[model samples]
Target: MNNQIDTLCTESWSCFKAYDIRGRVGEELNEQKAYAIARAYAEVVKPKQVVVGADIRLSSKAMKAAVCRGLVDHGVDVIDLGMSGTEEVYFAVQHWQLDGGIEITASHNPADYNGMKLVGRDARPIGENNGLSDIHKVAVQGHFDNCLPQGEKLTKGCLSEYVSYLVSFINPDNIKPLTIVTNAGNGAAGHAIDAIESQLASLGVPITFIKIHHEADGHFPNGVPNPMLPENRAATTQAVIEHQADFGLAWDGDFDRCFFFDEKGQFIEGYYIVGLLAEAFALRQQGAKVIHDPRLYWNTTDILASSGGQPILAKAGHTYIKQMMREHDAVYGGEMSAHHYFRDFAYCDSGMIPWLLVAELLCVKSMSLSEAVEKRILAYPSSGEINSHIAEPHKVLSKVKAHYSRDAVSIDESDGISIEFEKWRFNLRPSNTEPLVRLNVESRGCQSLMEEKTTELLSFLDR
Candidate 1:
């Protein structure tokens, strides 16, 4: 087995990323790589038992089987959670108190790509800084124990319990009669939605679902389920408008992040959703702590202040957000990228939880999604994140800072350059994986100022 790994893996693996493993299937990530990664995880994490699941991608099952084989060969017991979302693996790990878990998914990447998300006990993320680097090293070295007894595998499920757990976030009885449009985009979200819908029906919650692109197809006939893209959002928006629904929801390939659209088919910015969820948490528990990314946060901070919640800022990405949440014991954490994390769910993000809470908030507040966020949008108008490609990202960041730093009220580089003024602020962050810089600008009650600043930053970056 060791010789097989050494012969098969002659080159350094390219699938390892800053947060998780992801790459093109055949060229970068294959069954052999998956097997090596699994063995590496067994060696590094040393978990006695692990839970594994795969998304609907065509390569996922084979990747998952290779992973399982490696784990079993390492004498690590495996719990199989056949075709499921990334969050399901998270749920299974924490709910069952397993040692670790992995989900075979590329998560909104193109059809030709596939990868994995890994977590340890309590569903703690295993990213590059923590354990992923070590795992990568071990996989490349191809060293393993040859004396341990082979372990066994078991097939189990938690769909019903997972549905119940999702429902427990909100009082189902409080849900008012409403029509909702849900677009799964041929991802793994459809099954979970169906299960949740059935559970809500059994609980007598009167919510009608108008589902579109709700089948699991690895070919992605409707396109990849990335609602974050402008082109991918039209179908979900049109569904809401055509159905005359109260609101709409959408999820990515692995269903870890959820996106929302208002009744008027206008897609809500994820920043506003963060504010809404922060307010909801604050209302539920006075002085609740909330974690937010450091991109565009005037509205989030303002809402937290008025709602009596403490807002903690963290660098963007799941691993950093989860660490900050654990550090502060925050009740909830949100990223403007539609990732919502909760304390109750082992500090893990869930595509299912965010929409459920938004639905309940709608019923309780008796306001449309647009109405709920309109005032905040007006008060703290923002330029949604805009990405610009650059050959040298560091030079661009330095130029932006050098230009703005002297007159800036304050400058922060915890994540990237965040320059603040009395009335407006902007964050220019370089991408971890690509030659791009993402800029987000916001101004106090000044949409025009935000737009002007956004344009100015882009123009400067282009130079």
Candidate 2:
């Protein structure tokens, strides 16, 4: 304990990332560090009352306890939500109108890693631009002020209300008989799915749920629940095929991001999902304003334009997307990365809401998931994001910019360098925590052109 305190007070914390706190257990994060972080958060935000939760990682429980202890020690009341996902913390903070919240999770990271996501009032993320840096400073120094009257601690559960609110997004009457396959990947999504399943049954929505790996196991018996990896997707796709379900959904460990697979066991890229959801919102509320990231948004913009919706572009990140959603009062905002934000949900992202909305759309449109997104996919063929490692990202970016500027019709550098032409467009942006740059190319109604441009852009890295 003494050694830990000395280390906390003397050393800098490498876990403080740009948007959230995340690192390997023991080496970068531990119980002591978690406590210091929570205390620092308390001193910085000074919330009267805050909610705390944790994912099913082995280290999460200990981390959450330390965090709660620190909060209470700083005279900040703590509301323990028990074992929950990142979005649940966001919901509790916003739904209960609490001062702040924290969820101990690494969200798709390996089992040896655990971290925390912090949010302020109304669940606004506490990123570097906001208050996370201040928290880091206090935590690293470990020079907290003398303890005041220790705040009380309490326990609460909001799963039922949260599921009810999610189901409220769609009319049960519109939902038709369907069979759906859900791959929880042994994460926290199963709990939410079970609650939603019961709610749908009570509402007389005749839908069958085929669940796989539907238990919270920190051991991750079936590997991590990250659907982004091609290897990790085969299980859900195979399950969808074997069950002959209408569609399938999968979520990460924290259940903040959701991924979809069609009835044919095809993994639909998230780029198409954004356009599908944008069209859904536009049809429901005519001329609805939708926010989208700058990366690979031709399909989204085209759909919004045709659907009589206004398309607003923001930098590609959850923090920026949520902030922009609030600024424009956008009804919905989506990142091709599968983070969906809604205005009614306190401008926070929810994995459960996106799937429900998509399911309802399937019933209302009388279309399969594949059929719903087929046209959009064809209209804008995209070379899903490709990443390249470069020693000096700036020099390569400069070269690419100079080379492309001559033929580029327009260039926007809001988030990264997005250059557009009459037939195709591409966005190149540096990774937040690596020497890599990500590139996404899309062409209007031309897969071959999109592929050609993607190859051309990738070759720039070799130069």
Candidate 3:
């Protein structure tokens, strides 16, 4: 046992990141390390009953089993929801009132990578500050105390219930008959979409779904299943244009974030979707509080104000956003990265709910998705997040601040450095998970101004 522990501890703990566990599958996160992580999590969290799920990764099954063994060994009963998106585990934890939950997934990483996302009761994320740090420390130590009697494992299928819960977010009768293209990117979203479609059909909802890359292939034959990348969006855009669909939708590996494309096959910036959804929820319940990240704002803030809702700005990560949502009892929260959080859905982000609400909005407004977003797009044009790899992100940020602080109308450094001028503004922040610095520029109804500012910021950052 000592020799085994020594071997496990020798592996790099880099897989345990700020928000969740993630790394290359074999080298950094094989079965032994997975077992150690689960054991460490069990020791730290000490939950009586936990829910576990995995994405359709080639290594996920083995990892899942190893995690379950560690949890069960620690006398924690495990509710296994086999092959699921991260959101499913979130749903199961809250819906079933489990003590905690863990989903084994690397979420849109390459096929060679796999990891885990952990949550406690009510689906609150276990992040670095909250519990992930302790987990990392204990995981590195690779030591655990075994229980006298191992806990039993059980399998639970929540897809039907999960689909039903998702459908309840919007009235099916209000969803108009429409042709839509959905690109699953050959990940776990296809199955969820299928289940939702079945439920919609049962309710007599007339919706046409043109599915692309629908298979859950762990090999990711169609690239890495990430829709954020421009190159990855080509197939979905082309399919939407070829099918002449109303709009298009795409999801990453674990389907936590969803992306949208207009009828013209133009990729809609996620910044606009945050405003759209905020407006939708605000109109449904007037004066509702909406939470938005500080990265890209004006549009969302304007929409919320115009719709008689309060806008609260939170930090840019899921963990921070979820915490803010609960604090303010916000109706919804969104990040420009396409993660949408619903208070009704236990403040966890869902790729599924955003589209449902958007579809409902299209029906009620009697407009195409493009028409719905066109006004907002023109009102607040933006440069979608531009990431630059830099050795000294902080130094570059300071340099940019020094250049603009003199002329800036307002400057804020809550998550990153955000400088505002009269007509245009930009935010430059280091990524929470990666070494790159992300820059976002937006102007008040001025596309050219946004372009100029984005280029200017890149010039400073590139140096």
Give candidate 1's error at residue 155 in angstroms.
1.8
Question: Per-residue lDDT of 5-77 in model 3, one digit per residue for the tens?
Answer: 8987776778877788888977878898888888888889889999999999999999999999988988889
Candidate models: Cα lDDT each: 0.92, 0.90, 0.91
Displacement of residue 427 (Cα, Å) in model 1 is: 1.4
Residue lDDT tens for model 2, 1-463: 4676678877658888878888889888999999999999999998999999999999999999999999999999999999998888898998899999999998988889889899999999898889988999888878876548899999998999888899988888999999999998998889999999999999999999999999899999999888877889988889899989999999999999999999999999889999999998998898899999998898888888888999999998778888889889999999987899999999999999998899888998899999998888899989877878888887888899999999889999887799999999999998763357988899999999999889888887788
Q: Per-residue alpha-carbon lDDT of model 1 for 1-463, expressed as tens digits?
A: 7667666569658889888999898898899889989999999999999999999999999999999999999999999999999999999999899999999999988999999999999999999999999999988887778787998999999998998999999999889999999998899999999999999999999999999999999999989888878899999888898999999999999999988899999888899999999999998899999999999889999999999999999999899999999999999999988899999999999999999999999999888999999999999998887878888888888988999988899999999899999999999898664446888899999989988988888889878
Give me the displacement of residue 202 in model 3, in angstroms: 0.5
Off by over 4 Å in 1: 1-3, 7-9, 433-435
Superposed Cα deviation of residue 29, candidate 1 (Å): 1.4
What clash pairs does model 3 have? none
For residue 432, model 3's alpha carbon misses the true position, in angstroms, by 1.6
Residue 264 error for model 1, in Å? 0.2
TM-score of each: 0.97, 0.96, 0.98
